[model samples]
Target: MVRTACRPRWSAVVGKPFSAFPREVNEMIEQFFGPSAANGSTWFAPLSLWEEEGNFFVDVDLPGVAADAVEITVEKSQLKVAAERKAPEGERQYQHQERTFGRVERTLVLPESADPDSIEAELKDGVLHVKFGKRAEAQPKKIAVKST
Candidate 1:
């Protein structure tokens, strides 16, 4: 008679399959981040930030949001953006909802070289664009050295 060694699966030893663990985690994430009820719960939006030519640019996605409802402020080394997105009028029932609504706020820590006074922002095409100019003193300066 020939016998072969067999390895025990982790799920089999734990009673529940390991594959179900990921699904449970996903459900928890969705429950926390996904939209809830009809007019309750807060959600986060996507933001893009980058730097170019001694200037920092921040792009915030704010679709379905009114321009008048948005506000941007620069305080110390922190940049704050606040906006509100109202849901459509006469809402009945939703089978599946993913889009976020209501008050939304995002804050970013500015670089040490960022000039708060030179900050500018404009919202166009449902996207909020903010630019921060670096301080002149923070820019690199050329120095001349004498040959020995």
Candidate 2:
């Protein structure tokens, strides 16, 4: 009989396997960040979306980004948010650098119910809040039933 040492698989040590992530997750990552090497200087601003009272809302985290450096646009059924975070001016030796400085952009597809004309956006406390009101037809309508 031969004896051999056992070793744990990479997936076992990393929890979920790389393939365990859903396709949509991979697609979303690609859509938001693009290929890793495509733009090494570029970083992404995390964001969240939700719906309430027949309206949609999106909030994006933009830590050091300036309001003037941000741009929001809507075309057709798509909404695009872009911003730039500039690094500190003047030359300095940095002990450590973790924060990212570059252009970051995200494009979202608005639902058919979304009203582009009703969209509103505001930036405060390093967060960008975007709200999209629902179309008149898309708003919930209470139906009445009549008895003969």
- Per lDDT, the best of the predicted structures is 2
Per-residue lDDT of candidate 2, residues 1-148 (tens digit): 1222353322222665665344445444556666343434356677898899889999999988899999999998999899999989999787666566788888889888999999889999999999989999999899999999
Screening candidate 1 with a backbone cut-off below 3 angstroms (N, C-alpha, C), the clashing residue pairs are none
Winning model by TM-score: 2
Clashes of 2: 0
Q: Which 10-residue window of candidate 2 scores lowest in summed lDDT? A: 1-10
TM-score of each: 0.68, 0.73
On the 0 to 100 scale, the lDDT of residue 19 in model 1 is 52
RMSD of 2: 9.1
